[model samples]
Structure formats: structure tokens, C-alpha cells
Target: MDYPPDRDSWFAPLSLDLILKVLNVTFFHPFIAWIIPLSFRAQTMHWDAPPMLVSIAWAACLTLAWIAGVVNHRLAYGLPRHVDLSDEVIVITGGASGLGLLIAEVYGMRGASVAVLDVRDMENGEARGVTFYKCDVGDKDQVARVAAQIERDLGPPTILINNAAIVNGKPLLDLDLAAIDRAISTNLLGAFYTLKAFLPSITSAPDGGTIVTMSSVLGHLGAAHLTDYCAAKAALTALHKSLEAELRISHPRVRAVLVEPGQLSTPLFHGVRSPNAFLAPVVEPVDVCRAVVAAIDAGRGAHVATPFYARCAPWYNVLPAGLQVVARRLAGVDFAMRSFRGRLPVGENGERTE
Candidate 1:
């Protein structure tokens, strides 16, 4: 299988995420923050001294903020469910390659029964515990048939990852009706189809199950030459929220995880460069895989946003229209897709190379 070529330079690794990662462990960490004041005291610094006072205050603020963050998480997400890999039957769409493949391989290696549903064959041919099913999610009949087959072959699926997607790098005016239909069908309606086909089995399980939606930051911030893609993703975000709300009431054991990542170094968006590499660096599939795996393993519903800019994507909508346009110009959000050369020429059926 051919992978996307790496075009990043030595400095590409020096992104804001890298800087913040270091700061998080060293400065922002509550334990490390307190260490500063303790170190000052070890040097015989008076408690009321300017330096000591400042260090103590900084530590106090960090500690309080950390506690608040924990409280907020608990209040927002509630408690996590129990997860046992041996008993899990996992299903991942678009597991033929890229992010979905990475996740399938992870669980496959960990002794879980993983079923991969995709229109194409698995990129690596095979995996240890993964069974590949040739199914296009955009086709409701295919999804329905595959769901039944999976239940028979691998038992009821306890985890479902809706990660299948395709990019049609064309402006709205340039896109034909077929292209628009394919994009929306595959990117948005596909999730609905899969959920409808599999949710019954998932909900009927004694331990319940998890549903993961793979959205994008572009969903929140519409970009040029990606009208169909953006619109589909935006709808996906809404679908995820509504599904979560319904599951919370109907089946409290069912978990819903939402992942909205920035541009990833995958063939899905090959040749699309970030306008500001430091501030909006391309995300890695592995980074996203880690977050998804962590949430599933912990049996918790999470709002996973990769790359710092992705987490801030929601605020873009709240800004004034004039400021929004200025910010878009500065970030080159609309221009980013101008050079987009996706994995391959997508068909009207939304065929994806990765």
C-alpha cells in the first residue's frame, strides 16, 4: 500500500502543540507548579518575599485551575463504563487505510474481534484479529446486510467507529449534482445508516456499547473548494450531538464519542498545506488514534479535538462577520483547499483510496 509522502521539514516538528505539550507537563502541571514554590523555600526564601509570594500565587492558581478542570469533566461526562477487550466486538468503517486502519490494527493486536467495513480492500491485506467486509456505507442495503453478517460472525458489535470519508476538492459551482449527492450521502447519511443498522444490537447488549463519530474542524469552519465536504461534516457534528442526547435518555449505558480533528497527514487531504504550520499544524493519524482508543478503552464519551486549533474552531462562529472574514483571510482557511489533491479521483459513489 502506498502512503502519503511527507513534505514537512525539520522545523515542522516545532509546532505550537509541541510547545504546549512541554508546558503542560512542566509548568501547567499542578505538581510541577507547586514544586516551584517548594524549591524557593528550600533556598531559604522568606514566605512573604516578592519571588516566593509570586511563585506561591502562581502555584495556587495552577492547582485551582487543574481541580476545576477535573470537576468540569466529571460533571459534563459523568462516570465511565466498564470495558473488557476480550469481550468487545469492534466495527470500524473505512478501515481499509489511514486513521480507521490505524485504530483497527490497534484493537486487532489487543485481541479484540474487529470487523472492518469498506468499499475497498484492506490496505495491508490483513490483520491479526480483523475481518474485512466489502461494504459501502453510503449504500443502506449494504450496511444493513453487513451488520447482520457481523453479528453472526463476530457476535454483537460493542463499539462502532464511523470513520469513512471522502474529499471532493471542488467548489460548489464546479461540483455536479452527482458529486454533491455522493459526498453528503457517504459523509453524513452513511453514519445514520450504520447507526440504524447496528444500534439495535448495540443497545440490546447487557453492557451496552459506544458510537464514535469522525467529524472535522472544517465542519465548524467552512472552507473553499470543499462545500459538499464541509456541509456533510457540519451535519455529522449535529447528528453526533442529537444521538448522544437520545442515548443518554434511552440507554444511559450507551456512550457517544465525537472526534473533530484538523487536517491530518493522510492521503485524504494530500497536497493541502496549512497556512500557518506552527499555529495550525497538520495532525497525525496516530495522534487521533490514541485519543479514540483512550476514550473507547476507558468506556467514556468524549469530545476529542486534535491539534490546538481544532479545539478553538467553535469560537470562530461567535466572532463578528467582519472579524470572521479577516480571520479567514489571515488563516487562509478558504485558500487551503486551492491546492488540495486528495487521495485519488473520487467517484460519484465516493470511492476513497485511503
Candidate 2:
């Protein structure tokens, strides 16, 4: 299905994130930094000259920072395992649409054995190589049966992507028991069920495997209307951390990647407004899919956050309660979901039916 246009106005087109992306490949780059110093020296400038000295310092700082990033990754994620697309079987939950569908389609087209498990049918029908299985990941019995089927149909899965998620944009007081249960079960327990069913196959793979957990920034900053969703996502982040620590000692070859993206422009979050357009422009599924694909292809663990705000969201948690409350008010976190219309089934007239 075709995605809606960005529709952002001219000024909305510019963001701090866009500027940072440009700088990363230019002025802030080590190569670019060194080039400035070399160009200054080519003019026969003295070593002690202000421009030359400043350029050298800048280059040194950039290089050191780059080195530190490498060191940080080594310490945090350890080493990468080997992955061959031809031999790796991938299983993605909620592979019917949005981000999960994108990842499944890419892997399928690239010749990896792919299995898509979702209660809904493939949104755009079957892709070239993706095999669809109708399974609600929240149900352990169904997940177990599908796992066995996948194993028999296409060897053992070497990569698992836990991307299924559902959101009910109602206040805690307004949500019914069934709605709360559905949100928690699908968003949190589904991950646990999938992991329990697939970890054995992932660990048993000869070349090891990777696990991708789809989380959200809401997990870090709870909002008014999303109490249950926030709680579930927060638990997922903790689960990822604990699992990573445990696997580091027992199955070092298995990698874990955590994706925490802000408001995405998908059917899942149809009418929700962004708190700030320039600061938190809704992320596209393709942008996020690229990061996930890269992490899986490299066989390394990573924490993927889009837009500048998401990368800095951790700092907000350290702020005082009063300040956090003020920030939430200013950012409209509580009010953003006021008009939310999720991806419930719709008829041809573009009106929701369920």
C-alpha cells in the first residue's frame, strides 16, 4: 500500500536532526576536520597560528570522540556474530503491516527464509518470499505450534524480530478491563511468548542469532492517556536489558537490538499529533526499517532512536518531577493522543468499521 505524503510545511522540513545529520558527514567528521587542518598548513601557516591550532584541536577531538564511540559499542554489545542471509531464517511478529511488514519484505526479497506471524493477513498480499502464518503471538500455544511449523517448513529461525504492538489511546480510568488486558498482552506478553518459543532455535543455530525488540519512547516517559501502553513498553526495555546481560554470559553469539522510536507516521498511529514538528517530526517506518536491517545484517546489538529528541530522552528522566510535569505539559504528551484513530479495520470509503 502507498504511504501518505509527508505533508510537512516548508519550515517544518528543517529540524535539529536534519542539521546534525548534515554535520555528521561534514564539519563534525574526522576526515573533514583533518582536511581543514591540512588546508591551513598548505597556505604555509605557522603551527602556532590560531586557525591551524584550532583546526588541529578540532580534528583531534573528533577523532577521539569517534574512537570512544567504537570503544563504547565494544563494551556494551561485545562482538558480532556471523550471519549469512541465504542460511538464516527470519521470523517477525506483526509482519502484516507497518514496520514489521517492511522488514519482512526486505529480507524476503533479499533471499532470506522469512516467516511472518500475524493475526491479520498480509496487508498488501504475499510478497516474493515471505511465508505468512496466522498466529496471535500473545497466545503461547499458537506461537508454539507456529514455531514447529516454521522449523519444518524453513529450517530453524536465526533472527527474531519482536515488532507486534497495539495501542488503546484511553485514560487509565476510562479503559475497560478487556482493553487494558489486550494492550498488555499484545504489547508485553507477546514478546515473552515469542522469545520462549524461538530462543531455543536461535541459540541452537550454528552461527548464533540476533533478537530485535521494538520498544517506544513512551516506555521512558509515561504519558497521561497511555498508562497501560507505557507500562508494557517500559517492561519491554527492562526485559531487553536483563536478557542481554544473561545472554552475554551464556550465549555471547546471540545479539540483541532495541529500537525506541518516537511518533511514527503509520496506520498504527493515524490521527495522533506530534508534540513538536521540528523537534519530533513523526518518523517514517522505512527510516526505522533501515536501521533495524543494518543492525541485523551486521549481527550486532544496538539501541536505535530516531530524531534528536529520542536520543536525549534519557536526560528527561533525570529531571525533577515538577520539571518533568511542566515539560510534559509544554510538549503536549498528554494531549497528543486526544484525537488518536488507530489502525482498526476500515472500509473502502476510508471510514473505520471496527
Candidate 3:
């Protein structure tokens, strides 16, 4: 099958997600389920008739399932804390552009204190409430110094978005040690550094804080040319789980959010293409930002995965090794990066930030 390059295709808007969205509001919704049975009754159909009985059963099942989902989340993640946007001081790494920038801008417009930490300046210049902090999260010293400055400048951060990431887009053997180190430090260790530097302030704050990790589904499904990227992301997910477990016993108030999204329409993965656009469509930066904002504003812990298939990616690990190989081939997992032409590295200045 020929996957068209990023163009205004006639079928561009058609995707598995679009189909599901339509179904959720109609067939899968509890309200719609009840409406079906009510419509049959309005037609003067017998109560025991097949359509009425089936619709009634469907409505009951959907309602019960909805209730069970709410119960499950409450038991697993605990109750949501209060979120007052006015009191929030958010710190987003890699917020100069892409998904991180979108998030920072949204919170900034809402009148919250927003600090954007990046090696480069803001790609679109400055937003209303967002203050750009020129710092490389990959450097522990830079992270520490910036943390102190942020405290003095805009109060201590009550939320940390660990969104800083870099991809060399190379195989393990082909990548030089220096490139590997940069990727590991920025993608994996950067999160640890930020948490260590900021968690103290977060714990001390009366409102507590939320830590957001922008992970990837490729973490679970290690790609052909993304060895370093996969390893770092895999570790990130593990870190999120371990930290959440520790917080439950110790802090209990701080929330941890792990976001595992598929390919996104960002310059970072510029030339890469999804194997199947319908089943595994490229996510929009805005979509990921919206989900993260909802989690933070709700003051709750969440494991968010986008484009539908990302949520199912974890189950891939349970398959037989042979089947895994076959699935990878069918999904074109390893081959997806064959045509990779990633974004060029940006410097400390605004130049070459793209």
C-alpha cells in the first residue's frame, strides 16, 4: 500500500479514531443506548420484542460499564485533588516549540505562571504569561541553577512537565558514543534531574504538584533505527511507575502523569511516516497538549496514550517472540525509520531552532 506523503488527501480525515469517535456518541454511549430502547417503545413495540430487549440490555450494560470504569480509576489512582489555575506555577522543559510549547502557551493564556526551560529561545517568541528560561535540561548543573532562578523569579514550580527529548534516529552500532550519551542524558536522565531539583518544592507547596512525562509508544515497541530512543523511553515509563509507587506510600498528594503517544506532527520526527495512517495516525501536538492539560487541571494521575493503538501497545510484550516479529513486520515498526530525516539540532540561540 502506498502511504501518501503529508498532503491534503481526500482520505486524510478518515481514520480509526474518527470512526470510534462517531460510534462512541452513538452505539457505545449509555444515553444513546437508552434512546434506542425508548424509540422502540415509542413505536408501540412489545416489551419482550427482540429490538426492545436487545436495546434495553445494551443500555444496562453500557451504564454498568461506565460506573465500573469510574470505580476502577478511583481505586487505582486515588481521588483527584483541587486545581486552582491562579495558584499554579508550571515549569515545562522543551517548551520553546512543539508539544511542550503548545502546553505552555495554553496555561500562560489562562493567567497561570508559566516557565519554559529550553536550550533555545521560544520558537514563536514569548507568549503572555510564559517566561523563557534558557537552560539545557540535559545538564544537571543548568537544571539546578535554573530551578533556583525560577523560585526567585516566578515562585517555585507547582507542576513539572518533563518534555525535553532528542532523537539521533540511528541504529545502535552506527551511533557514536557522544551522540548516544547526548540522547540518553537528555531523553532519560533529564527527567531524573528535573524531578530531583523540583520535587522538594513541589512537596512543600500546599497545593502539591503533578509531574508529567511525555513518553512514547515506541518505548514499548522498540523500533529498528530507534535503539537509544526506545531504551530511554522504556526507562522513562519504568521511572514513572516506580515514582508513582513511592509517592503513594510517602507523599500521596503529588500526581504523576505518563503520556505515551504515537508519531506526532512535529519537526522532531519530520520525514518519518506511519505504516498505517488509519490505524496508527500521526498525533497532533495540540491533541497531546489538550490531554495533558486536562489531567493537570483535574489534579489527577493518569497514563495517557493517543491514536488508540498506543493504549494497546503494552500488550505486544505478552505475544510470542515469533508472533512479535511477524507483527512488527506487518506494522512496519522497524522499517518506519528507514526514510527518517529528523530535525537538525538547535543551538542556545533562536537560530536553527527548527
Candidate 4:
């Protein structure tokens, strides 16, 4: 299937992310920061010299900040259980296409027992270690049946990735009841059904298991013409948080990973445009997949955000209402979907594509 072309200009790729990545390695990195002080000392600059003193102070601050980050991570997430990919049985929803499919294919190629539960057939046909189960996640009965089959075929699931979602880029008033139902059912409610079906096996597993929830930045920032989609995604974020809280209290061994990405260059948002390519550039599926895979491999509960802005998306909600309005206007979140045609063209049938 043909997807949207990049249609980006030469400088579109230069984003704050690029600048940060460069700085992280060169200056911001604690190791690199210390190197400057060492180099200054090697040059025999006096310890009290202005440049030497400044370099030493900078290195000290960077080192302290780096140590604090390590401490924060340890306190926040605790220890990570060792993960052996060969022993994992992973199940991905909406694995027929898009980000879900990318992850399934990668894990399949790596020899993990992967089960893809989707209403449609696998988009790229079957892969090495991946099994396709034709089931709609929005339907609890189907999810249960498929869960049983997966247990019988691949052993009890050790990982669950809740990646199924649909988008209807229409204003609240413009959307019909059916559209709203479809959005909430497949996006928010599907996660609940999947968790209910799989969490038991996960919590009971020898090494426990990981639960990954795929949400969006739009969930935190409501956008015009995407009321239903935004609301459903917002609920997903809440569900992930609440589930994480409950699991930490009751099922401490089971890990919960929340993934919130900005616009992806996928069929799910086919015609949707990024208002500012340099600021909120369309995210690539591989980057998101890599982050998810790393989090799962590390066997730790993680909050993964793609690109750069998504990591700071929650701060938008903290701004005053008037400032929030101004921020939305500057970001063009409201009008980003003005030309959204989604996966389906003007008149084509809309099959699930997440």
C-alpha cells in the first residue's frame, strides 16, 4: 500500500531534537564536560585562570546533574528484572500494520515467540516467529479466545503491547455517535480488554511480564477536529497511570510502560500535516519501535516519548488556560487535521490501521 511522501523541505529535518542530540554528546554529556577541564589542565593553564576555573565549574555541575539523574531513575523505577528475549512470548495488538507491525516483525526476526492479534490479516504477510490471530481487540470475547489460543500455542504471554487505535479527524459536533463509539471502543476500551485478558498470565509468569500502552501527545492537548480521538487517547493515558499505580501496589513484579508519540508518518494519519515540521516533525515508526523494544528488554516500567517535544507535552496542561490557548494556536494543534484523510481515501473502505 502506498503511503504519504515526505513532502518536507531541505531544512525540515533540523529540529530542536537534532540540536539537543549534538549537545548531549559534545557538551552536555558529563564525560565530555570533564574532558574540557582535563584538556585545559594538560595545556598547563593555571588552576586559577578564568578559562580553567570556568571549565572546572562547568564539568562539576554537569557531573552532579548526571549523578542526580541516575539517582532519580533508580528511585523512580526501582530495579529492572533481567530479560532474556528467547524466553519471552510477546503479543501485539493492531499488529497488522504501522508501528505495531514494525515491532512484531522486529521481534519475530529476533526469534521471540510473537503473536499478532488483529481483525485484518498481517499487512506484510507472516514473519519468522510471529503468529497472526484474526481477532478484533475491541471485542472482549475475541480477545479471550485469542488469549487462550496464544497460551496454548506460545505459552503464557510474557509481554502485552496495547497498540490498537483508530482516528476520526472530525470536530466534536461533526462526529456521529457511531464514530465516537468506534474510536473509544477500539482505542480506550480495547486496552482494558487486552489487559484483563493478559495481565493474569503476565503477573503469574516466572519472570513477570511487561505491559506497554501506546498513547499520544494529543491525549494531553485536545485538538480541534479530533475530539473523539483525543478524548480516547487521553483516557488511555489515565488508564495506563491508574493501572501502573494498582500494579505497583498489588502486582509489583509486572511492569507497565507508557508510550506517547506525536504525529507518525503512517496511514493512520495519512493526510494530517505537521503545522511546523522543524518543531513538531512527524515521528518515524522505527524510532518509537526502538524505544519500546529497549524498554521491554530492560525489563523496566518506562514512559517513552518520541521526537523531543512529546517528552515535554505534559507541561502544556500546567500552563494557564489563556496561555494554553495561545500555545495551541502557535503549535497549530487545532488545525493540524484540517486536511486529514486518515488511512482511507475520499471514498475507500476504512480498514483498521494503527
- What's each prediction's clash count? 0, 0, 0, 0
Full-model lDDT for every candidate: 0.89, 0.89, 0.88, 0.86
Query: Would you list the clashing residue pairs of candidate 3?
Result: none
- Looking at model 3, report the run of 10 residues with the lowest lDDT sum: 1-10
Q: What's the residue-level lDDT of 345 in candidate 4?
A: 26
Q: Which stretches of candidate 2 lie over 4 Å from their true place?
A: 1-11, 345-353
RMSD per prediction, one decimal?
2.2, 2.9, 3.0, 2.5
lDDT of 2 by residue, 1-354 (tens): 333534453125777788889999999999999999899888999999998999999999999999999999999998888889999999999998999999999999999999999878888988989999988887789899999999999999999999988888888889999888878988999999999999998998888999999999989988888999999999999999999899999999999999999988777877777878777788888989999999999989999999778888989989999999999898888898987777675333424466
**What C-alpha lDDT does candidate 2 achieve relative to the native structure?**
0.89
How displaced is residue 124 in candidate 4, in Å?
1.0
After superposition, which runs of candidate 3 have C-alpha atoms over 4 Å from their true positions?
1-11, 348-354
Predicted structure 2, TM vs. truth: 0.95
Model 4: CA > 4 A from native: 2-11, 345-354
